[model samples]
Target chain A: MTTPLYKKTAREIRDAVRSGAVTATAVTEAHLARIAEVDPKVDAFTQIWTDEALAQAAAVDAKVKQGVDPGPMAGVPVGVKELICTRTGKTTCASKILENFRSPYDATIIKKLDAAGAIFLGKVNMDEFAMGSSTERSTLKTTKNPWNLKCVPGGSSGGSAAAISADECAMAIGSDTGGSIRQPAALCGCVGIKPTYGRVSRYGLVAFASSLDQIGPLTKNVEDAALSLNTLCGRDPLDATSADLPVPDFTKALTGDVKGLRVGLPKEYFTEALNAEMREKVEAAVDVFRRGGAEIVPVSLPHTDYAIATYYIICTAEASANLARFDGVRYGYRHPGAKTVEEMYVLSKSEAFGPEVRRRIMLGTYVLSSGYYDAYYLKAQKVRRLIKKDFDDAFEQCDFVMGPTSPIPSFEFGAKTENPLEMYLADIYTISVNLATLPGISIPCGLTASGLPAGLQMIGRPFGEETLLRAAHCYEQTSGITLGEPPIA
Target chain B: MSKITKQDVEYVAGLAQLRLDDAAKERLVREMGDILAYMDQLNELDTSNVEPMMHAMEMTNVFRQDVVEPSLPREEALMNAPVHDGEYFIVPRILEGDAS
Candidate 1:
């Protein structure tokens, strides 16, 4: 019996391919077989393209035989979040509205990954239009945590995180708009990074909140996260928002050095509201940094308390405008027997969108409406500036800011579903980073007393991914925390 | 200061074109009220002279050239629709002047 290829990290699989010990076809086949075996129980994938993945892996093997060096992600299997466009497969955004949608062309990142010889495993599930924090809001199917099948993986990118953690794929790409990627990564016990807003191209990424959305990598460890980011980052002409900056060698920066580094622990982040177990795990991670000759200082982000409210308003307002394109006439689901175009628009959106998505769209529409725009959307934008200023000031005093990614570990599937306010509050610590347009990462720090993984989040200055990765890499090395595998039957 | 009402929720849902059930409306009313109450903190911060910001970093006129590019064909664009006429979308009559 062969060990599952999905159980290994991208780097491990890449090493096997490089050494010729295992062919790319073998690794791809194993992952495809594993998805077939496990995805039904977990509901992680929205679309599985096994035949296409096998074909792609065979082409990669052919190139390797001809002495061609496929780039960093060579022969590794990865899952694309359903929101991103893939030429060969369907891209639904996990919404009933776009349930049957297929892109004629690939997203910029997809094209790049294909060129690097990475095989596409399939499209993973997500919240409808990436609105809600939990995959429960998906119009298609719910994505469950691999750790506890009843618990959510923490979403909109819940499926991607669960897929990676459950050994469904070697790695997965997810988007972060108000912590969609990191929150789920934390909950699922995987390594996920939300690159600085413009660091990665968002051209073909279905816009959630343009300013807040960034495509990032979800992997089993810090090193794989680095490798995935290497292929995904850089400027693209297709996306005007993509920064015209040089892509750094993220792997080269992971030398695991935190000596003489100043790490800031935001006092506001550790509050009475935070779960005691979560705080303890995060603090313990900070101790590892302290032991590595790093100084931990008490810092304050005074504006942090208002982050959730500001993030919700701004993100929803932007989403309402962005989603206006799906009016049933141009694209997506349409009402079968509507009398007029307006009725068609109404019926399509109402039927296609899940509850949380509709809630956001409503809130967004209200905020962006003529009379309310100044009081709500404009005010939120101003508050957003102050929030960013707080980070700018904090970064001057310390190299990175550390905190708990979520107030609690993975919760039951419908725990907060009834109360939308509670769900919004779950993203408290994470939304500020998006508002600030800073780089942030979530790495597994320790397991809670309940044995579920807890993540310690680190925030760095704008375009300061190198500093943040170095700090995380240092902790990852010294902490001696081995990756946990899901008990997939 | 954050005085939200059921009417406000209804009005917003209408603007969003959402068909909310009684339970959803009640739930949204409560949640939106709580959210608005939390947002009252903004009123405390004096903004007499402070300028409202639209983006975090100072970026201005971030646009691309209005270049003509290839677009998806009509058939491809209509691929995701649930129901479509030959060249246009088909829907129930929402306004008058239609065969009911």
Candidate 2:
């Protein structure tokens, strides 16, 4: 039997749409229909943009009819995490404060993808302000792992990753601040990329941690991620921090060549912290590289153990400052009974933010508070320098640092939520990439004995996404993980 | 590492403008204590001579040309405001006034 149109990769769908094998409308409809069928079981979407997506797809079909080039991401159904600003619908960040807040303008990537002919299937759930390691922190709804409804689809991009895993969308755009993109991608068995820190624009991404936050795509495989990079990369005048480098055709880098490439295995990532099965899966990935004619080098990142602690301090500090914009006077939820300005600010914020959000804010405030700034915040910034230096030193010896994305695969809901610090530990392998401003990709490598997916994370040098994509493409082809459907309906 | 106290949580809450009731404050005191204790690990690293890195990729003073660019219109900008007065965001009385 032929694969469903919804199950086709974005590249295949784009080619078929261009060649007239299928209409963009049909592709969009199939995905929408699939979402209707499976998203309820996965709870992936917070709001499905049925009408807007159809309109976008219809325009793609119209372009094909008129012989107009429909741009690179043609006819792809894309799910956007709710934190990204989209003028068509509310950009809630899965929080009560902005639950109904409509953005006046679309984010830079949103505008770019719309121009590229990708349909916005809808806004999906995420941790409130993209702050948590699990979707449990999302105030909208909990997004579950597609492989097992009982387990969490790792977050704060859980909705984006789960939607792709469940065949609800052709691709998804997610933000990574302390592994929000890669960790979830790892758990859900999707290929998620967090490009070099300033490689993509963050103009309309509601800032979680300004220095750490970056936007990238979560797709079913590496090729589509390459295509997404082709469309999404380059300097954005809207975002000051966005790099001015020339955007390369990332697809060309996926030549599946790994001979003579040096892959660094950071000894710290494979230590006792990693589960035995996860370690075995990652070690198998090392063998895949060895067999592919790539040299496996052992590198030490001595500061690796400090990543989780350092990331939490820096991110929360930034989040505390970034989230200060949600005052009652501006857009978003506001309590009506305040007779004084001070009362309004306090009451509105207290009522709007969730528990995790509140905890982070308080922590952030404490770190930046006058007496403690140098001790907590400044010390973390220095420690962050050490973390980045470790990567720099490692990259000097190898092309990519290879390891497991998360310490383990997806876990049952509420397993780590009780202890915020425990949840933070899940992202240990991914946090340093953000801290160092390097590109990283998490592609499915193997599944656990019980049938959950494990991801092999590859960290590339600064602005070295080309090599990383090539390596990911190469590893994915040879690695024995079979791309199979989840047990869900 | 210092112990995180209820007073500290309350003080930080005031600074962050999040009004926390007693239950919330109690919860934060414990949670923040555990988290802050974990952060003490950073104290182990002797960063005496290290410069603090604020951003991962450093680009300083990115200035755009001084050209006029259209921004979101007042109406569209105010569309999502909870208490907008058409031309402005209406807020609670800033000055201390008589008790209601």
Q: Cα RMSDs of all predictions?
A: 2.4, 1.5
The true-structure Cα RMSD of candidate 1 reads: 2.4
Candidate 2 chain A: 10-residue stretch with minimal lDDT: A480-489
> Per-residue alpha-carbon lDDT of model 1 for A1-489, expressed as tens digits?
366676787998887886677889999988888888889888999888888998989988887888788767888999999999887777888888887787877899999999988999889999888887879888778788887887888988999999998888888999999999999999989889999988999988998898899999999888898888889999898887788889988988888889989999999999998999998888888889989999988889999988888888899899988987888875688777666677777877888787777877878888898888888888888888888888988988899999999999998878898888888899998999999999999988877766677888999988888888888888888998865666543
Query: Mind giving the per-residue lDDT tens digits that candidate 2 earns over A50-102?
Result: 89889999899999999999988899999999999989889999999998899
Give the C-alpha lDDT of model 2. Answer: 0.91
- Candidate with top DockQ is 2
How does candidate 1 score on lDDT? 0.85
lDDT of 1 at A52: 94
- Alpha carbon deviation, residue A293, candidate 1 (Å): 1.2
Model-by-model lDDT, in order? Answer: 0.85, 0.91
